[model samples]
Target: MCQPPAVALSLTVSVLAESESASAALVVPHSPVGHHTDLDALRAWAQHCDVVTFDHEHVPQEVLAALAADGVELHPSPDALVYAQDKLAMRERLTALGLPCPRWTRARTAEEVEAFAAEVGWPLVVKAPRGGYDGKGVQVCREPAEVEPWLSGVGEGGLADGLLLEEAVDFTRELSIMVGRSPSGQAAAWPVVETVQEGGINTEVLAPAPGLDPDLATSLTEGALRIAGELGVTGVMAVEVFEVTRVGPDGGTRAAYLVNELAMRPHNSGHWTIDGSVTSQFEQHLRAVLDLPLGDPSARDAWTASANVLGGDYAELYGTYKHLMARDPGLKIHLYGKGVRPGRKLGHVTVYGGRSGDLHSLEALRERARHAADYLQGVVTE
Candidate 1:
């Protein structure tokens, strides 16, 4: 999506939202996500921009500390994006950086969520540490009267300073690494995808994740480049892991990985690196927020699967685009021109090199990217 021989520019804050149909000399219009609390219109849109980024991480760390006190230039700064915009400050800074988290806490009473669910037991996981997404402020309580309407504020907001719980991980899937630092610290990683969630969004991904374990994909790309160099992160961070699978002590079978969420932008599990890597987590997040020099996230195929195209009851997705481009002429679809509801996310479909690219089978690249995303979400038709 960072197209053109890259000289980018598409800033949005949805001034009448028309999802990136670029060219109006490259769309601009700021102030919308959380309604930018005007600081001289974010310092006149960072004095006509030279560097300032974000496609989500709900900006507003005091409007990125008043555009870094007016000097602007924020590629992940804002204290490394408040650990991807607060989830109880990303589980207290990834459990004080020892990482491998998921047995968390922070209840604020329903008697501290029934004493942290009687010491972490009953179907835990509660969340809402500031504006949740996809799964919407999460929940899965299993009792404590379902966290009494988010601690009696009914629809969140009266969360009354409380909600974060955890301890539901039994994972054996959901991976995703994607790095790319820069702003001089230079970094780069990729290949470590597997996603595929459902009600909580993210429908499919797969990439270098089919049977991973090349030393656990080099320890999940060196722990996502050490959490993008201990959080000084510049651009493109992604990192949502949780692959667990235990049993050792000579009994055989082991693999562990945690750290479940964090995305400083350019995700959807690296959208299968656009067309399957060799550079493209949106051009390495525009060459690491314009610090330049960064590319080659490797994988130009051996398998690349993508798939997400949620919105349903198909509102004429170009009438099945000539039968999904004559039935997968090397499928690639993208779409996002918004306006469609039921479980939103309106586009995605990538499929590359399989069946002669020698099906490096993951169910043959997830049945050819879920049959071109279930025939562009009309949910199959031949």
Candidate 2:
């Protein structure tokens, strides 16, 4: 996460470049929580860095705007980043771009939600316009009975000034495509990974998603690239797509993928690259924002799988490293140094290794990864 404000980068590169240590400098900037970094401190630090980028798009737009005005280079400039920051803006832009997005309408109250739902159908998906991450600000509404209580509770403008109502989708599988581009227009794409989410939060990602037809991958990649290019996106961005199935006239089934959402940074899905690919997303992000040459994204091994340790007991789970290491000497675990609360993405574990083109099956790799995670959390005996 320490890719911006030159002082932090210098300290980080110095440490990582040294062969002995792997720990890097991390710059904590001002956030909505008002707990850590503040804007003045960040602006002062930005004077030293050659370029700046992000791991998440939560930085206030005004701060980015002020930085740009003062001659700081922000990759995927704030103008472009806005689409990723605000869902309302993103939906409008997607429609203007003629992309295939789920049909949606905006509502400010229960009455509006009911009207929008009637116009569409029952069992709609409602989302807050801003500040919603993972599954926190989303709800599934089967009818007005479920909508009124939520409206009265949040009072529409208080928590969710604007709510989005969309038709629920029935899909075959969810997939993510990570694409990166340099300022010079050099672009690279990574292998697609199938994602599984539980209770609105991503829980697992299987690399080189099995059974994905070559044609489908090609189309998805091309579409993702096109969108990035049109949006003037620089650095790494992940596009999540849902594969929807429909019945054909001749008693057959047809498949089509729809754009689910876009994230313009190093996403959790790309975390597998730390062990599986020649270059990880974190490094590529550094290159892109620095305007340096992009690196190869090809997987060095055949298979890779990632499992998230989510919504767990942190205090009871923090000190089990020895047990985890005992069971899986080969497993690679990365724990984000954030206090764990329920479903907070405390960290991830990735497992991968095999012949160049003959990786282990997803089921086998995922099982091993899960076991390693359970061991680390003391849920299973080592």
The model with the greatest TM-score is 2
- For candidate 1, what is the lDDT? 0.77
Q: Number of backbone collisions per candidate, in order?
A: 1, 3
lDDT of each: 0.77, 0.73
Question: What local lDDT score does residue 285 receive in model 2, on the 0 to 100 scale?
Answer: 74
lDDT of 2 by residue, 83-132 (tens): 78777777788878887677887776777887877777889887766667
Global fold similarity of model 1 (TM-score): 0.32
Clash number for candidate 2: 3
Residue-wise lDDT of candidate 1 within 1-382, one digit each (tens)?
A: 4543254443232231122343221333443222345666557556766787776777668878878887888888989988887787877887787878778888777787777778878888888887677778888878878878777663445244578889888888888898989879989888788888987788998887776778878977887898889888998988888899778888898787888788888888888887888788877887788898898888887878888988888875888889879977878888766667766888788876654234345577688778888777777786
What TM-score fits each model? 0.32, 0.85
- The C-alpha stretches of model 1 lying farther than 4 A from their native spots are 1-36, 43-45, 54-56, 60-123, 129-146, 149-151, 158-167, 170-178, 181-187, 190-214, 222-234, 238-243, 247-251, 265-287, 295-382
RMSD of each: 20.1, 5.0
Residue 36, model 2: Cα distance from true site in angstroms: 8.4
